[model samples]
Target: MTAHSRNTPQFYLTAPSPCPYLKGQFERKVFTHLVGDDAAQLNDLLTHGGFRRSQTIAYRPACETCRACVSVRVRVDAFEWTKAFRRNRALNADLVGLDRDATPNSEQYSLFRAYLDSRHSDGGMADMTVLDYATMVEDSHVRTRLVEYRRRGPDTAVNGRGAGPLYAVALVDHLSDGLSLVYSFYEPEHRDRGLGTHVILDHVQRARALGLPYLYLGYWVEGSAKMDYKRRFRPQEHLGPAGWELKDG
Candidate 1:
């Protein structure tokens, strides 16, 4: 056995559990801790290698006999907005996104609670408390930013931050090569507006403007309706054994 150095991350596998994306299937994850001075740089490389960060740990699916979880990243500069995407963008013309330090507050928690109740009531994170929400935002040992979406209101000229109530929020990580969308949620009542897709489109444009090459959108599980939307982002790359391959379809 090779001796491990302090800089080497130790990997662990989660105990088999019921798969969240697939019915009647078990799932496991291979993960390692993200900490210390090199955590940010290590996270960037691991993320490109198909790992995803959840708080202080970086993980990816490692289930036996399953290849359903595919990592996806948009080609920022080449992404073309579809007619529907354009419409969604127009629909949200009055909305503005404000990036701030990852500090949890009551307002964000209220919106987060409503989002969980309406969109993911039966999911694992549905029962998360305000403290849990805070940990999700503030527990990171990496470069993270909280992007809050709100509608423009009176006195918009005074403060650059959007006014009115919060409609969506995304926890994003800044990597060396691109931006990683860790998690995002929106006002479930406005689901018809396609706020989720719109946020992604906006992020893609932001990444391109910043000279970044990709926008990570987490895992795309095959056969999961909740994850089907990810495939709509054309000119995306999917990570596989052979490496990241462009998916035209």
Candidate 2:
């Protein structure tokens, strides 16, 4: 066998479970643990092959009879700033995103709990405690960072850190090709600010500044209202049978 196949990670499959995004449908996943020295490189390969990283595990949909989940990545350099995107940016101009180590804190947990309660109360992670949140942020074996967004203060220019209450948080993984958005949450009360769109727009800027080509946005499922917003970011590449194909407006 070749070196590529020799180092190939072992994968396992999960039993069928109720689909979170679709009604009356079941979902299964093929997953593998991302660990050891080759974790980062392996992660990049699997991600390009349509896997999503969650803590130390990398998984992709392996439903028996369904193929609704599709992986997507933004073409940062080619992304156009639409009028709606500009509006979101303008609305969230007062916020500053501070990149920090993947260490969890009580304040972040408070915001996480509030967000889950208000938005995803019936979702899978609704019962996640503070410890679960910590594990989610710190269990990663690859390069990871937490971007905390807060309202800018007078000292922001001097310290380069946001002040006041946390407005949103994004757990991101730095890959060789681009930034992978693992998970993000925002203050539910601030929904009017369009924090979700702002987070993605900020990541596009970050990818451009870092000279990366794509911003991995995980899986986008058709017929899922929660995932419909991902389609708004134009000029993205969708992973398909023939490989990544550009989907422009």
Candidate 3:
């Protein structure tokens, strides 16, 4: 049972694996493939329904006992530009994000490898090879873009592109209603610059500029300090039993 008729996607459940966020617990996922002519439409629908995409697969946690993986999205127009956020943005003012087609390259992989080795050494993606990273970037069926963060060059104003080595990268999906932050990585050595927060902040302004209402930020796992950063970008709407509910800053 791979797919159903009339473009109805077939759903499958993954076997339980050790939970990454919570110790002594397991994690399972219900997922479907995003393919065919309706891939983008299906992705839009699934993401709104609390699913997140990896390559061409759309999945959400199916852990029966735990419901901590909460889908979160930032309201672009209602976003709070707090003093801390302002300072963080100012800190990375010299860096610029250049949006390009979702094509994987060696340079991006090098940065990604270094980031994983430094910060997420024991995480799931720590063992991913260059080929895996390339597939992750290029295997998408829906509209996706890679925003490479680099230092601003002398001719940045003329060409509208960044300069120098890559410091951070964000894999984003352009949905019908919003831009989804699929995955992001940064140079772990520059921890003081808050590159992760900077990427999200840049996307918030990008969403506003594009007249998009939301910036889908995948999930926010409760009690996971690693997931706590998602909380700073407010005001955000958390998807729940009643759908997305707004939370104040």
**Judged by TM-score, which candidate is best?**
3
lDDT of 2 by residue, 1-249 (tens): 645444568899999999999999999999999988889999999999999999889999999889999999999998989999999999999999999999999999999999999999999999999999999999988999999999999999998899989999999999999999999999999879999899999999999999999999998899999998899997899999999999864
Error of 1 at 244 (Å): 0.8
Clashes found in each candidate (C-alpha, N, C closer than 3 A): 0, 0, 0
Clashing pairs in 2: none
Task: For candidate 3, give the lDDT of residue 20.
Answer: 98
* lDDT (10s digit) by residue, model 1, range 131-235: 999999999889999999999877666786788889999899999989999988888899888889878988998789889999999999999999999998878
Alpha-carbon runs more than 4 Å astray in model 2? 1-8
**Model 1 lDDT at residue 145:** 95
Best by lDDT: 2
Better candidate number, 1 or 2, judged by lDDT: 2
What tens-digit string does per-residue lDDT give for candidate 3 at 37-98? 99999999999999999998999999978999999999999889999999999999999999
Model 1 stretches with alpha carbons more than 4 Å out:
1-4, 154-159
lDDT on C-alpha atoms for all candidate structures: 0.91, 0.94, 0.93
Query: What order do candidates take by lDDT, descending?
Result: 2, 3, 1
